[model samples]
Target: MSDNKKLSYCFDVDGANFTSAGEASVKVKKRLREAGFDPETIRRVSIAMYEGEINMVIHAGGGKAEVVIEEDRIVIILTDEGPGIADIDQAMQEGFSTAPDNIRSLGFGAGMGLPNMKRYTDEMVIDSRLGKGTKITMTVYV
Candidate 1:
């Protein structure tokens, strides 16, 4: 790939389908591998994006996921129109989860999503509104 070239991808996340939760991240991981990114970089991006995608599905009822591959870093943006996070600080705590019991029974919703996302990425930012939605941008340096 040319030094100036950038690869971008967009996907629609289906919140209603638990089976498809990690689809976007899986696709991203494949793309990163094909693009020759280092395994560690690809791993971090995949994990961070996967956590974000799950959050979008469980909290917002689905949303959009976008990935941008630049020369020095990878960017993952997740946007959802569900109820926004009311307490970002609390949510960042490792075991703090608001996931419903039904979702918990499915083996997810352990409340580690945000914390894991933050832990795996070099940078993470969350923009949320009380009744509107949330937008999370994460970057992993190559």
Candidate 2:
């Protein structure tokens, strides 16, 4: 790839399908590997993106995920139109989840999604509007 070139990828997450929740992250991991990124960097990106995708599926009912690969960093953006998080601070706390019982039964929604996302990424920003939606942007330095 050219030094000045930047690669961007987008995926539509299906909230209704729990089995396919991590597909986007898996694809991103494959792309990063193909691009010869270090394993640690790829792992960070994949874990962060996976948590964000799961959150989108569990909380937002579905959303869009966009990843941009740059020379110094990788950026992941998740946007959803479902009911927005009412409290950003609470949502960021570890072990804090609002997922329903059914979702919890599936071995997910243990309240670690947001915390794990933040842990894996170098930087994370969340913009949410109640009754509207949420937009999360995360960056992992290469």
Candidate 3:
């Protein structure tokens, strides 16, 4: 807390490895807990980050995440170079998912990733291009 300097963390989401999809979120939860964030705040941040990580794995093939802890908020940014989201509004719907049948069979791709991420975070913004990539930024107030 000295100097009002923010704490920041970065993680690489490896889409090719489903076994480690949520590792970054888990590490973040540990760090937040050690930093003395309240239980509820920790829960929200972890859930939102986990959801975003999953989306990056299943949809984008892989991505990067950055989490920054400031005096008033926890910010999570996810970036991926996969096939970009074609319709953000449609993707935001509770049950609208473009995940293939194979992914769904693994008990994922429930169409809840974006919705859950938005649900637990105080603010969320999505930047996407159909032929390029996607970037999602989420914030949870402290």
Candidate 4:
């Protein structure tokens, strides 16, 4: 692919199936590896994408994930139509999770989703509406 070309991938997250939560992220990892992305970049992209994928599964009841491979960076975008985040500020706090007891019992939803996503990426932007949905876009420079 040329530097001027952008390779994009899209996946529909199946929120109804917890077992398939990280499948999209895994695909992203494989794609990055095949594209010859550095290990560190691939790691960052994969982790961030995984966290977002889990969040969508546990909270949003499924969503959409998109990865765009650019010349110098990788961009991951997650969108959901489930109940939107009521408070982005509080949601970003580590360990502050609203996940139900059942989800926590499964060892998921520690509320580190947003924080970790921000930590692993160079830039993170969240666009959400309470009654509408949410859209998160994160970018990692290569």
Q: What is the C-alpha RMSD of each candidate to the true structure, in Å?
A: 1.2, 1.1, 1.0, 1.1
| Candidate 2: residue 50 Cα off by (Å) | 0.8
Worst 10 residues of 2 by lDDT: 1-10
State the C-alpha lDDT per candidate: 0.93, 0.93, 0.94, 0.92
Mind giving the per-residue lDDT tens digits that candidate 2 earns over 27-122? 999999999999999999999999889988888899999999998999999999989999999988888889999989989888888998889899
Candidate 3 lDDT tens digits, 13-90 = 999998899999999999999999999999999999999999999988999999999989999999999999988999
- Whole-model lDDT, model 3: 0.94
Q: How close is candidate 3 to the true structure, as a TM-score?
A: 0.97
TM-score for each model: 0.96, 0.96, 0.97, 0.96
User: In candidate 2, how many Å is residue 31 off?
Assistant: 0.4
Task: Give lDDT tens digits, candidate 1, residues 1-142.
Answer: 5567888999999989988899999999999999999899899999999989888888899999999999898999999999999999999999999999998998889989999999999999999998999999999888
Stretches > 4 Å off in candidate 3: none
Where is the poorest 10-residue window by lDDT in model 4?
1-10
Alpha carbon lDDT at 34, candidate 3: 97
